[model samples]
Structure formats: C-alpha cells, structure tokens
Target chain A: MRRNKKERQKQLKETIMENPFITDEELAEKFSVSVQTIRLDRLELSIPELRERIKNVAQQNFADQLRSLPIEEVIGEIIDIELDQQAISILDIKREHVFSRTHIARGHHLFAQANSLAVAVINDELALTAKANIRFIRQVKLGERVVAKAKVINKEDAKGRTIVKVKSYVHKELVFIGEFSMFRSNFTETGDKQ
Target chain B: MRRNKKERQKQLKETIMENPFITDEELAEKFSVSVQTIRLDRLELSIPELRERIKNVAQQNFADQLRSLPIEEVIGEIIDIELDQQAISILDIKREHVFSRTHIARGHHLFAQANSLAVAVINDELALTAKANIRFIRQVKLGERVVAKAKVINKEDAKGRTIVKVKSYVHKELVFIGEFSMFRSNFTETGDKQ
Candidate 1:
C-alpha cells in the first residue's frame, strides 16, 4: 500500500525513534521506499542522523536521570537511562583503544564502558561493584561504536546487592556480555574480602 | 641481616624464583647492598632482569603445563601454572592499552589477562566462561606489568561447574580481582541460556 508522503514521513520518524541505530537501508526496506526517499523524508522532518540523535539522547538523559555516579565517571556517554531500572550508553573505539598489532578493541575498555553503565543505573548515593560474570563473544574493531545496555535484573538481595545485566554490541552484533553485582554502600555487609 | 655477595646471590636466585616481579632496588634493600651491587650479583649469577625473567618463565611454563587453550589463544603468557589447581600470567601494558589523553590502562586487558589465566588453569579440553564477577581496584597505567593469578577454589559441583578465583596485581598492589565460573564442555547441562 502506497501511503501519502506525510503519513510515510510520520511513520519514518517513529521508526527512527524506536531504533535510533537502524541504518537508512534497513529503514528503507521496512518503509517500502527507496533509500533516497527515506533520506529526503528524514531531512524534511528535521530529524538529525543516527549519530546526532544518539548524542542528543545521551546529553539529555545524563542531566537528570543519572544519580549514582557523576557523568564524567561513566566510560561511555549514557544515551538513555532510567535509574534503578535500565540505561544505555555508547562508546566509539579509537586508535588508542585497540592493540597496535591488531585493531581489536581492548577487552577492558568494553568492560569499563559497560560496567560504568551498570554502575550508573543504581539509584543509591553510592554503588560498588561486588561481582561480575562476563564473556567476550566477539572482537570489536576500532572506529566501531559500541552500544551497551544495562538493566536491573534483580534487587531482592537481603544483603543489598542489585544485579545489573550489561550487554555491549557493535551495532546489532553481541560483542560482550556481563552481569554485574552492585552493592549500595549503605547496606554493605560484605566483610569477607576474598 | 647483611650477607656476603656469594651467600646473597644464592638467596637472591631463590627470591627471584619465588617472586619474579621483584625489582633490583628491592633486592638491594633485602640484601643490604647497593642497587649497583645487586645488579652486579645478578649479572655474576646469570640472572636476567625482571622482564626477561618473566618472559623466560612464561615460555618455559607454556611449553609443558598449558592444556585448556592454545598458547596463542591465551592473552598473556603463562608464567606459572599447576593445571587444575592454579595458574599465573603476565601482561605488560603499553601505549595501546590506555586512553591517549589519560594514559590509564584500559580495564578489559586486566580482565583478559586474568580471564585467560582463569581459563588456562582449567584442565578441560573445552572450558567456557559461564560467569565472572570482577572489580577494578585501581586504574592501571601504561608500562605497568600486570601479574594475574587464577586458582580453582571449588570443583565439587554436581553439574560440573568449577569456580576459579583470579587476582591481578601490579608490583603486589591489587589492580583487579575476579571470580570466574568455568563450564567444561562435557559437563554442560545448561539449557537455561540466560
């Protein structure tokens, strides 16, 4: 069905908002239009590109939704967040993040970015990472923008540990996975330092 | 507490074997000798510097003790290992491991060196990391040599999951710590892929 340009443009805006990382080719395929038409529609709607949209979302979200840690402490920019619930952040790997011999992004940078988002999701005044089980599913290369999403999976610990699940991806491909155990400082009962 | 050079050099060899990361200055303090005297003693005894000693140990250990993963697959070189009991590896962070602007070592390399040691300590043909709980105690810097030790804490699981404890240090200061749950391929009954 061929919808009017106005209707198509409105739907396009919704689609982009739903998945900010969606590529123009994928959007064109979904909207049943040429790539050029999608671009033209996006231009007419004054919606910035995916990169700009991500930046806008991050800058806007970090101002109010973040409470557990300062914004600068986060390894990546928080693109979206709901404290004590879920948060999303993005990190762009550069020359310094990868091995000089091989362009694979260092694993700790990815973990730092994801772990920072995981730590940032707590609503408490201070959250300390108690534990994490993680895996590197794939190698991330330099220049790739990794998006990490951290969600609170469990907060029912009697000892006050909130389990935050963090998954980082290069676009849609899963690159790293981790579950972080964050402890609220006020409820710290962990004395066995092993 | 001061000893003659012959006696001190004999003890120094043993001390270096026990802790290969010990520096010349520390050896001097221990032997009540000047730093240059310690260097002269090391040369007389054909003892390599700390960096060379570490590389030698890793190469020697990898040739005989490594079983779970290939030598290349392990991120850092294994300096010492006792199969399913415990293992140690070393990673020297360089310019590639830090933020160009900050010079602080990235976190994942620390995890990788530890995680790899955790995996290498397992005696199985295929051991997969099921979970890891880790913490970064301090920011690592470029030019730091990270020594990660992994020891199997428990292997008594009915379902065959082994818990490995990994601790990474820079000159005896804790830089990173993790507890890794490794799943051997033969023992995997994990239908719940969460």
Candidate 2:
C-alpha cells in the first residue's frame, strides 16, 4: 500500500513547517527518500533554498507585516532580531534582488531591510525614517550571502527621535555602511488601526 | 567645411559638462542633429538618460573628494542638499545602481540612500550606523525615477549620536520610509583611518 505523491508532499510540508530550517539530508532521512527526492519535492512546492526559506518565513512572521501588502520592490527577509540598543540580523542576497544589468540593487532595498528590522523592535505599527547618511564601499554580486547588522546609538523620548547605525558585509568584508534616524508614530493615531 | 562625428561628440561632451541635465531635444538642437543622433551621441559617451546623467554629475561634484573611497552598498548620488536640525537632500535614483538582485538587495537600499545623505552633512569622515527602522508602504521599480528625502530627528552630544529620517517617493507617491541613528567616530585617535 503506497501513498500518493500528493499525500507524501503534504506530509513533507507539515514536517518542514514544524521546522522550516531543516537540512536536505535530514528531510530525506525522515521522508525515507533520497536527497534528490526531497529537493524535487521542495522545487514542486516552490520553497526557496534553505536559507532563503528561513529568511522569508522570518520576515513573514516578524519583520514587515506587508507580506500581503501590494507594494512592489520588496524581496528581502530578516534572519534575526534584537531590539533597542542592539539590532542585528543576517540576510542573503540573490540575483533576483538586483535590477537587470545593474551591479547592485537600488540603495533603498538595503535601507529597507535594516530599517524594517529596527522598526520591528520599536513596538509600533507606524515608524518613519527621519535621516540617514550612508556610504557604499563595494558592489555585491549576484547570489552572494551577506549580513546586515544594525544597532541603536542614541534615543530621545522628549524629541521622539532615535539614532541607528547599520552595516552590511559580504564575506566578512564591510561593503556598505549607513547611519539612520527612526521616528515611531503612535499606532492609535496612525492609519494601521487594528 | 564639415566637422567630423568625433568633433561633434567632443562639443557635446563640453556642453554636457556645463549642463549635464540638458534634455535630449535641447542637445539635438544645440548639435544641429536629430534627437536620435543626440541619443546615439549619449550612448557613445557612455552616458545614461537625461535624469541619470544629472544624478551622475551631481554625485560626482558632491562626493568628488570621496570618490576614491571604497563604499560597498550605496547606489545613487546626492543631487541637492539642505541642512538644519537633521539636514535634508534631494537624491536621484539610478537603475544601474548595485544591490538590485534576486534576493540580495533588500528594502534597506533606499534607507541607506537617505541615511548616507544625512551622514554626508556631518563634517566628519567616519560615522557609524547604530540603529535604524523603516516601513515599506510602496515599491520602487526600475527606471521609474525616484526622489530620496532625509532629515535629522535627534542628536546626542554626550554620546556622539545623531538621528535621521528618510523617505523615498516616485512622482510624489511615497515608496519607502526609514529612521536611522548615526554615531560620530573620530578616527584620528585610532591607528587606522577610513
């Protein structure tokens, strides 16, 4: 009595959902199939590579809540978080992330990822970027895995402004660096009413 | 007596040097050639569209001294500047900018763009990004043309921290927003210099 491929896939999905960051070999062992079989299953399910899936799911759950938002120019995901004084995360870069015939993606993409992570820590639904001065030191290639790390340098409650610093590195080399300011708007007054 | 194509190209370069933002039609008329001919001249000179050329020239003049500096993540140039509490500037986005990748370039690119503009206002060489937050309400597309606007929100003299805010828009429609914190570092005391 053999189960249908659809049923097997469904089971696999559930298992992966339990822990989306499983290794291919582990998935193969659990499924009683070859690594190739597990890969095919993932391909059929449209699941990205392991790191990408993990990042995407993290972004969907805790990063920007705009997964359903109909805005263009969004494709990065958050991998980790630490609020307030310490903000940091790991991000993976891909070719699809870049516009056609360009050395790197637009500057905004990098800013948004780091900014979103910082916002997630703000405990507010509406946050605004106040100011930032950044520098680009290198060009990120396609499909290269990189890390985006940020932190809070200063805060002022009376003035309602916070200062943040972020750095993006490729293979341990500091590629891009930025310092930003974040303004947190009260969710009650903002349009993101629940 | 007829000027060869090379001579005409030289003249065009000089004209663009004076007014890089000149329209294609204006350039064509000035060169006594059709728009198509002028376009060909641009391509031969390795210059982008009118808007891109404007940004290129503006960035060149703005960061001329720091052009030799190695920055990895930034993609575009600072076109105009205004300073006060946090400082602000008008930046033009270019498609050829790096960070446009499949999953490589994140939303932070825009944030970094505005953030960098803010930091440039600082009369220091090295400022670190301490923390940042951002919201993605809209998406920026390739060749769509956008403006990055940033402002300072807060600063802590004791801690040497500054806060900045940034927003990106395509034709006045908000595309991305961000907040950042920058830390002023005096590298002179350190052994290495940026």
Best by TM-score: 1
**Candidate 2 i-RMS (Å)?**
9.0
- Scanning candidate 1 chain A in windows of ten residues, the lowest lDDT window is A185-194
The DockQ-based CAPRI class assigned to model 2 is incorrect
Docking class of 1: incorrect
lDDT by residue for model 1 over A1-194, one digit each (tens)?
56889998888888888888888899889878899998898899998887888777668668666666667778878778888889998999998776554576756678789877887889877665666778767667889999999999997476577889998888899888988877665675644322
lDDT of 2 at A165: 78
Off by over 4 Å in 1: A1-79, A82-85, A89-113, A119-148, A151-194, B1-65, B95-106, B137-142, B188-194
- The alpha-carbon root-mean-square deviation between model 2 and the true structure, to one decimal in Å, is 10.2
Per-residue error (Å), model 2, residue B60 = 14
Error of 1 at B96 (Å): 4.3
Off by over 4 Å in 2: A1-35, A41-53, A64-76, A82-86, A91-120, A131-146, A153-156, A165-179, A187-194, B1-194
The residue-by-residue lDDT of candidate 2 on A1-194, one tens digit each, is 23578988998899888888898899888778888988999999987778888767766664453321212232344555555655555556665455344444444455555555555445444445555556555556667766777777775544466667778887799866776656655522233211
